[model samples]
Target: MTSEPAERAGVPRRSLLLGAAAGAGAVALGAGGAIAPPAQAAAPFVKGADISWMPQMEAKGYYWNNSSGVRQDLFTILKGYGITAVSLRTWVNPSSDPGNGHCSIEETAQMAQRAKNAGMQVLIGFHFGDTWNSVGVQNPPAAWAGMSYSQMLQAMYDYVYHSCNVIKYYGVTPAWVKIGNETNSGICKPTGSISKPAQMTGLLNAAYEMSKQVFPSTPVLVHLAQPQNLAGVQNFLDAYRSNGGKWDITGLSSYAQGGNVPTVLANMQTIQSGYGKPVMQVEYGGPVGKPTQVRDSLRAFVTGVRGFGGLGTFFWEPEGYPSFNGYNSSAWDESSRRPTAAMDGFLNV
Candidate 1:
């Protein structure tokens, strides 16, 4: 569940995977001639989906209405469908509420435990903002509303360490933890803006360091918005790594409405090879306007990602939209339902 894909205009697109695979079994036999195999294929890899943005706040009216029995039943449903991971977000502080209600530390821990108990890996999203954070906007939480530059940096470090500590102590440590959500603009606000890449890198490095210190075995993920921005992606990675940050995974937030599938796949391959780390499509989904269109886009996207040698991909919120007005339609809505076409693509490949 990434903020709408309204900010991904200038990214490049290339069909590296589909095109590269076309020449796999072809051999040059004569001048301007080649022999190709009658059959060609690509090996299958892991297929995982992300389930972040499930309503955690009861006041938001999107609470997991399912009882313990129902909750377990739903997990069984997902597992049977080949879903193997669950992602949840954590808010430092929410605007409507001071404490992290649905997106609190404790709530996330419980969700992680539930997913783990059901035999699914957990991916934790740590939004270093009060609410939404994306490429165009990445604001500090209301609690840190007036802190100075230095103070904010220290707070960011402390927050990461404290959060990791809690997760570790509860024995629900995430298999992968993102330092910040869709941090294309940067995180923790007035100080960590992308305008100052070095400053942003320093802040991210601090968080990464703290995360490692608290949970040495967990992988620290560095996420960016829109998979098509080649320059932005490379710039972010170069700055982040140069500033002493250590990342085990390169995560991307992509949406079908943002651009063409070929462009997204091409950019993903570039990043994956450039960083030498497994790439994860941390967030992706098509709007519910047309079910078939959405399903087809998802299928192509998933297949393209795997073809590019991606580690795994996760769908944003296959459950339902998080209503800002406090009325969640259901634990999972029809618009976000698991389309058979999309599910087949994931399960088969």
Candidate 2:
């Protein structure tokens, strides 16, 4: 779940292959023609950050400065710090609630294009809600609230299909597509609740299948929060397996408050072994003030995960600075208007 006080806060096979390869330092053609992908992706271990707050932040006059005090794009600064990929969040029909709104399909496409322009791989997450959805809250989009289970499944398919096409239209192909965000309890709740395992898995399967249809080679991730809860994670994945749900990867959100790095790492390894799926830390963050601690912790987590062949680790909203949607755990310093040492964790990783 987000820290906000307000509420919380694609492609063909041949072309798809090139897009994925482009994410790995190869040249691939996009709307703007040939572009080199991030070299870090070539390493095959993603060092990523979720800068989904960027569009809104820029709209609010927020910008970043390089280490030498030179103004630069946030993506440029992140790449300099060794970030190879970016994760973007999407909402069905979000409102303009500042902290809680504005990550609709259109905004997601624009951000994906910006990431592609910066030579970074992209990961797109679908919340399937008009607002925030996470372990604690999984409200169905208002438009689907009154629909039957069958109707909801169709809606999920259409939404994913349309969203993928928009991203493709923007000439950006995602390296990873997340079926749901932090869906520990299940997505599109009540009917799609964990208690209703079959129904829940059915909805997730719909999103997963739609993603495959659009981006045949892209991996679809099933994200859950708090890996420290081993039993909870197992139960969630077990439900998917038992219900015949499909997923290409297992993603997780592990914050400093959620558990220690070793604990999270161990749990992830166990899950990977038990489920036979690759794992990635899809969301993570540390206290902004403790730059050294944050840096060391992030470095340890990523290194440990990589040691075990874990896909990658991503810092959640690292571009978020103090007072941006009431979030303050960003790797950036508001006063300095530059990235804090915490971001250096990705350096040389």
Candidate 3:
């Protein structure tokens, strides 16, 4: 599914504050105007990649699974390329269709195990929907369709707890847990509107509470799509902080086609210094159609983010593409071969 438009479209704002404080304030700066020193850089700011539907990429007749020996080979390639983390998406229950079987919890756990074995950190992305869930589409699972809003909230809490428990129990402790994917437009849709700051805060708070309950030590990341829009980022954080919501890390999803990398990096620095928290480019990639441009953009973006105090980054999909018969061609070839140009970008960065 395509991503939703920016929620702050046409909304004019007076000031862009990182947190709840109102009025103009001094923007914080990293040491020497750079995010942590090179020696202190944590895990190369995570030149990472996301592989939610990789299993399907193989099933679609693109590549065989021999390269990674059950996908871990992909991580091995990623590790060789300097990628320190991997993100996986989980759905409550996807359709039984063979092509759409990417949301299985068991499968996700196995992938997480592979990543851990490969020495890569894992980020668990919970969609909360049975299918593709994003800010524009936050439909709950079918089982909870008839439940009231309150019931839905409880259900979300339970779902998060159970999922995190499973991951933790399996010895694949996710370094970061995103309650919902790209919540810029807000989850659960019409009912979950960030326009109503109070209501929005309530929904996010429920997720935050659940994460803290499940894994108190693990940092919960509040993800917003598109980093170039500073006003939108500030507005969401303001609303969140106003409603007593808290997050360990400030996360942004930036697509190369959406905005300038420098602008996005600057905005990230502003938010990180303002909030005194580490920032993560949680999701980002170049246009998948242009493989060469995608590679170049990924390299530039990763390097820029690292210089800007970025805690980490994850390429959207290194091994999935629509043109390859709906297969992801970023990481592997039809024979499950190792290291595509896109995969190498992460390592080379």
Candidate 4:
């Protein structure tokens, strides 16, 4: 999600909501742009963020000049904004260096340790690959690439069991574990495709079972992308369930900028009533330049989810500012190097 937007948009650094001076028509935050308390009754599920870039950015000396003119890391800044949770993405094998190193198993554990130290709940997402895994790209991990389908299932189980144990050893138990990242087309190539629901079942069940064995209380999510495509979601889930798939949460990703809200809301309703499953729009955002618009869009999303029986919402990779290297979805003001009102949207009204 981060790479796609940056490469496609070529967005420039946008101005921040001037020091304590809100962006035009932006939500009025507290003094120094601190997040005022949220309306608790309206926010039943977690209000969180996907600042997976936190470790990477902090390592790069990137800092936020908070509204009080004090320098703070993005994690501290987001916590100040009343964010209650954070989602971390981890890869099977660690990548090297600043560019791709942050999401490695070790870094993820360290990052989650810090988030737990901040008192925020955590959610872990496994890409199940050495790199990005999505609809178009679901290459198996190098070590698992040549194995038979059954062997792959065993590998996934062991991986989840070990990963969950490692994450717990860091003193943070994930409240949720998305078994696979954006598995709209399924994971691990021909074996885990929706076209082969039985295989999807094998892989998903292995991860789900191992994850449960380690963290019995945490809900497992079948995260899917393109929330507006209700048909795709329904068809895939139908196939998944028929093939013995199980999940507690319907994790969706969508953006209002694409006219997806109405469809997303309707889809949530159906998935809830029809499938008896709660949903969470796990990933969403718009261009950083449109602070007011993006904030309003996010506010609308959370509000609707509150009514829709969903868990929570997270703005993907809000930590990346000043080029994001290639991720354009950052909510930071490029010029000021601070979070914009879009980030503040997590502070529910």
- Best prediction by TM-score: 2
Runs in model 4 deviating more than 4 A are 1-43
The deviation in Å at residue 27 for candidate 1 is: 45
Predicted structure 4, TM vs. truth: 0.84
* Models sorted by TM-score, best on top: 2, 4, 3, 1
Clashing pairs in 1: 13-263, 56-102
* Residue pairs that clash (backbone atoms under 3 angstroms), model 3: 62-334, 63-334, 64-336, 68-73, 81-347, 318-331, 319-328, 320-328, 321-327, 321-328
Candidate 4, residue 298: CA error in Å? 0.2
Tell how far residue 237 is off in model 2, in angstroms: 0.3
What lDDT score belongs to each candidate, Candidate 1 first?
0.62, 0.81, 0.65, 0.73
lDDT by residue for model 4 over 131-220, one digit each (tens)? 888756887788898888878876876677667767766777887889888888888887787888899877887777666666765778
Error of 2 at 41 (Å): 12
What is the per-residue lDDT of model 3 for residues 1-349, given as tens digits with 9 covering 90 to 100?
1101111222121111211121011112212333233443454467778876656655665552433455455555566677778898888877755545456665677678878887878888877677777645667678877776667666665566556666665677787887777777767655566766676665666666555555555677888776678887787787777776656677788876424666777888898887766788877765444556666667777777777777877887766655643644354543445445555556555
- Candidate number with greatest lDDT: 2
Better of 1 and 2 by TM-score: 2
Clashing pairs in 4: none
Off by over 4 Å in 3: 1-44, 59-72, 98-101, 257-259, 323-338
lDDT of 2 by residue, 1-349 (tens): 1111211113222232333343333112222322212332344788999988899999999999987778898889888887889999999989887679989887888889999998999999999999999989999999999888988877876678767877877888899999998888998988799999999998887777667666766778999998989999888999988997777679999885424788888999999889877799999888888888888889888888898878899999888877877776888888878888888888877
TM-score of 3: 0.77
Between the candidate structures 3 and 4, which one is better when assessed by TM-score? 4
